[model samples]
Target: MTPSARDVSGKPQGVRGFSGALWHVATRAPAELFSALEELPPLVVQVLHNRGHAGVECIREFFNEPVLPHDPFLMRDMDKAVSRISQAVRDGERVCIYGDYDVDGISATAMLIETAILLGIDVCSYIPDRVDEGYGLNTEAVEKIVKDGVTLIITADCGTTADEEVALAADAGIDVIVTDHHHADAVPSRATAVLNPNSPDSDYPFTGLSGVGVAYKFVQALAEEYPEKLPYPETFLDLVALGTIADVVPLRDENRGFVIDGLEVLRQGHRAGLRAIGAVAQRPIETVTSSDIGFGIAPRLNAAGRIAHAQLALDLLREESASQAEQQANELDALNTERRQLTEDAVSVARQEVGDDPVVVSVSEKFAPGVVGLAASRLSEEFGVPAFVGTLIDGVVRGSARSPEGFHLAQFLGRHAELFETWGGHARAAGFTLQPVNLPKLRAALVEESRALEGDVFLGPQLHADGRVFPGTISFETFQYLDQLAPWGEGHDQPRLVVENVCVQTARLVGANHLLLTFREVAADIRAIWFQSGQHQADMNPGVRVDVAFRLDLNVYRGETRLQMVVDDVRPSAGERSLKE
Candidate 1:
């Protein structure tokens, strides 16, 4: 049966997607909005409307370069952080930049340390081992830093909520400037200066800065504080862009500006680490896009923390020597391959335990804490439920949880605070430590809690289209026009289009479980790729009529630029379905 929805463009849209998904097509905008943006293509206008940039001025401003980075002093304690760090620089006090293990943390750490060293401050970086020390500022790590005689600690991407650890450092005569972007439930009263835009005390205009983005702000404030000595702060946007995009923050406001500008710096090949990383990943550093960082380089950098020591990744980022950077980048690339295998194995084992539960909770000694998050995320996407995967080590469990929509992971974990040793994360993802015995209780609790859900969550597995496309309408030129809304990420996704009732020219299995497809068009055949969908080739053979949802992209292969359609979903056309029935 064809489920229909009346579109704003006065057409009937097929709303039911293949494999039980819901497809939403944005066919038009409000009359006033449409009239206001009549000069632009209707597809772009529809996309702009869906993204809530309906205002004419707002749309124009977006097309233009994003405004300059905001004033850093506007943050809650920018002055305090600058003054203390400047003092540390002047006095030659030993300082450390404590960072997390992920790409966001590693890149933020590198940026902050580079800034500090450039300012003539005696600084060293300390990123905790993901498997050994866990995340953030631990008391043991703080004590170790104290033993190193460090007097000041600048935390990058972490330490906002390390109240007790901050107190411990404060007791040992070390001051901590927590420069993080995570939500602060209660600002650490003991931190010398907390510089999170999301902090309760912050009046920073934008709250979406990533860990490295916050570090950029810190350095920007420092540049304003010391105009003469510090080198150009904009030089670090390469790192900022890498971290900001990798962290998956909304690519709006300052984040968008950073990526747009940083892509230039990253492409300049100034950073030896990124260049080497791009080479190892088979992505050209000179023309890297936000998409490149998210899929290509960032995962390799993150693999260091996931499979081994994060220090190696940090060393690569800070490496100035091309040879060393290449060696380290290659090492990270190998680790990424290993991490992929580990995650696949963990997910395979975890999948068997899912059964028919509304929520997935599985704990095993075989699950490594490093890749549990990936496994949990995979299971959540596959099963459309909250998944909690834990590594059972020595009677305790270090676990990661992932949820799709309509469930707040952090809030749910918070409700069961009594069962966990430590827990914290945002709405959709979280981590916790608890006794192994608590697994069954948490599982039962999650299932019970899921029963009360309104069930709208199950209605999803939804696909959103900016507009519709006919077989002959989408071209490379069309992609170029819509791409003016460039640097798409978390909140701003690349526009998708629905092409209904197109004839398949060919569908063949290509590299490693991917479907290489082509559709008949007026001027030329449209080449398409449906990655990981080789299993569907039988049904998508030549001459099959189908409705396909896809996004346009320009694939640069061996110096040739070709317009390619990345298929999102496909289903038999109404006529074909009727014929089969």
Candidate 2:
């Protein structure tokens, strides 16, 4: 009997060494099941089942059914939060919305402020400078807000683990309501209410909400009470979608609904700032998709935080004037361009400093604290390891860490809690602050901890394909069927299909490092594009047979729409490999 392709843990351990990856092609659906679902294509069924939506009802709900928002009251401490906020509104107390300096944080801040404004409450927003204050709630900022006569501090996208800061605010006679999604060690007892789904006592069925998602939940609950004040709750879904997609949360359950509905809201061009941002990004707001948010809009919003302060982005979200919104959008676009260059330069330097260690840790004053996370994320992907990138600032080290699939960053950081001044984030991404004296100890501890894991755990990337498709099966109709599964991100990735034994008819270099190729798939000739593969031009000569992993893409040129293959990776055909050897 043959062993299964999956390991004991059921993770796919594919046949290694095809374009430096182990292709984990999913097994085909059972014939009986395929026959039973004859209304749908077999390929769609196979992809859906692979994504854990195997049941017919689950499939239907995922593709067709509407996912309504869950009751925000389901979250523990919601009533307390609402009650305190309501009192502030009633007494006309000064309230400050303190948020982090990321897109999620900014969107959450904007959403809450808009809600408060709609309810005729006195509200102001504060987003700490990323370079100066770092992430999460800070004591100095709290003290300043308190000094400004703020009687209540409503935190969005942050304050989950700010035990000391929350205590400071409480001492200053300021009520604090923490609305965040980051994992917390323990709910800050000092906070008036912690509205995080990741809290241990939380009963919310969908724990995958982003910080903006949580804020939207708060708005939903608040609207229920003050329907006269907050008339249209759905008006804020655009911000919810922006932050939810930008934060890279799982696009499942309620999150899927947020994005699906939010996309509709976004398309309406209701937000002038979003319209300006779309104009700057060269993306039409009416035709924007999830990819547009992830690649085009989110970066510009994040750039304000990364390169300067997040207040610019928060203001943009709240701005109504088209001219002012355009100016703000242009400023953010410029910052994003600068951020990209800084990240590339920092990643290059960090790569040189990183030795052949299981865990890569690079620290230097040269790296900007704001862009260190981007550098760390890139390094993690480049080196196939957990990466910790930090910058030494005023005798303290501020850092960000990004991990691969197997490693849990928050858990790993928690194990060494005493080493840092502060630390908190989700499982895959986290940030921390520590003294310079702990650098050596931290490096040694990480190296020792990483040694316990299997060597192959961080070995290269793994490409998961939805089984295999023959050249003849690739059709516009098939692509349209797959297109029904919209709003893909995080847990629900766009499908990658494998085509075996296709002959390359022609290859030419296009823009930058992109390779334009013509492939003969049986009797059909299809146009395919492989980005950043110009260096592999020699391997794709005419008459060369290769196996390609690609995604179906719709290309429209000169009023004609055609199906094209967006190649991900290519390898010599199985037969050709044997001949070469």
Candidate 3:
């Protein structure tokens, strides 16, 4: 799907950028280390530290310039889950793999199916209908699985909260193994083994594994037990990377390894689905990155779930033939276009209905069930408030929600559980359902709860200087230092450089949403684009003196590669102390 640009806060140029630095400051990075690192160039060290690679060995291990994988058993439930799945395969019992409707769920499902198939188990895969089945396991879906001759079920990204559905499956004599990464309210019953990092009993080395990461651990454990039965499990890193990046999981620890190595596999273009998606999205397949997956690929995969059956995304990933993969890619792309239009219309309606309150709670009887979450998220971004965008499906009102910082959306929604038929999620995102008539109360309850919180709960955006770099500091040689710190996202992110006293030689709107600028500081000349900031051109005049946060990039045009800075934000220097100092 073609990506639509949205206005985001300033992009930072140094130390994993502002968010990364904020995490460090919040976590208490040593002053000496922060100061010393700042001198080295804020952007590079920030990214390095954000990835938990603070020194030489850490950096080497991070890039996998040297290879490493900590004990597989460190992952929660690795050994026990593996043993059970292996025993199930040996018993020749039919197994069904169920997953959620997003990119994480789809990739995890595909990973499980492929791994099981290699182990001589043709596990049946089930993805609940986004519009019809809602999120997670349902009693009807489980009963259907039981009737389909399945005895064991491996659930990816879901089933952690389906205590009742799992119990129902157990009553029918089916064993369930849940491999999910979603945060759960309490221990669930009926699963033979529940492998979730967030579970209280889990000692998983990382709590931030995406659904695909959890699925990969299951395969990793399987490979440990029967090395000869299946190929090394690392072959699926491409899928892991796609789902990991798409889901916006923290890119630290094992997650960093998964994405770092997975990006290389994706660059190899082994998956026809990724290749076809790159073609349809007009991205170069050979140079894919986390950004490409997040911005370019995931949306199209998600579009399938939002507008139609999520099975289409799973099918594209699981296609055995190149031709079939291409066909599915095209179909998903077309659906995504329609999905975008639907989301745009839904958001437009949501905006009109939402008032100028600190929180936004809106309901649209006409909103598409599939795209409500996207609409909610978009609305949250637009208004800088928590949002719940709901639609009536059948007799119940089902919806998705997006929350801002300090909102704890899932917990807040959970507090009002009496009003909901069912609900699930984490701090930033959540889902719920209720009788249609109950929405007004639900909306009022949420808004009232939101208003009770202190104002200014969110720390307004700020710029973190990586260190000062004169225009002269920018060169192909200097850029090599920047290039080593790559494969950035989620827990870690691209570096942001704070360049001060830059003269805005020129500025103008370019393309649909980007602001093109000609900038220079003493000894440096640069070209930059403030994407989605074109509307600010009126305020940012040529010859203006400003401090800017940006990333250095290369734009190849007419076969000539030239250096460019991707400006994230610009501020008048008179406001305060020099941010770049």
**By summed lDDT, which 10 consecutive residues of candidate 2 come out lowest?**
1-10
- Candidate 1 regions with alpha-carbon error over 4 angstroms: 1-20, 522-525, 579-581
Superposed by TM-score, candidate 1 places the C-alpha of residue 32 at a distance from the truth, in angstroms, of 3.0
List per-prediction Cα lDDT, in the order shown.
0.84, 0.85, 0.76
The digit string of per-residue lDDT tens for model 1 on 433-475 reads 9997788899899988887784545523566787766666677
Task: Please list the residue runs of candidate 2 whose C-alpha ends up more than 4 Å from where it truly belongs after superposition.
Answer: 1-19, 455-458, 522-526, 555-562
**Collision count of model 2:** 0
Tens-digit lDDT string for candidate 3 (1-581):
11111111353323332122221121223445545544354445545654566674554455455445567678666666888887887888778999998999999999898888888885898999887778889988988998999988999998888888888998999988888988877756767888888876778767888888888888887887889976678889999998999988887777878888998888898888888888787666788877778877899999989888999999888776888888899998999899988998999888788664666777777898988888988777666678888897777788988977778977887788898888888888999888877877877887776777746464223344344455666555556667776666765666565566667777888898788887756324457888867777875787777766777777767767778787777765433324446
Quality of model 2 by C-alpha lDDT: 0.85
Model 3, runs deviating above 4 Å: 1-43, 46-68, 74-79, 443-445, 448-452, 459-479, 520-525, 556-560, 573-581
Task: Report RMSD for candidate 1.
Answer: 3.1
Output the number of the TM-score-best candidate: 1
Q: Which is superior by lDDT, 2 or 3?
A: 2
Q: After superposition, how far is residue 480 of candidate 1 from its true place, in Å?
A: 0.7
User: Lowest lDDT 10-mer window, candidate 3?
Assistant: 17-26
TM-score of 3: 0.85
Per-model TM-score versus the true fold:
0.95, 0.93, 0.85
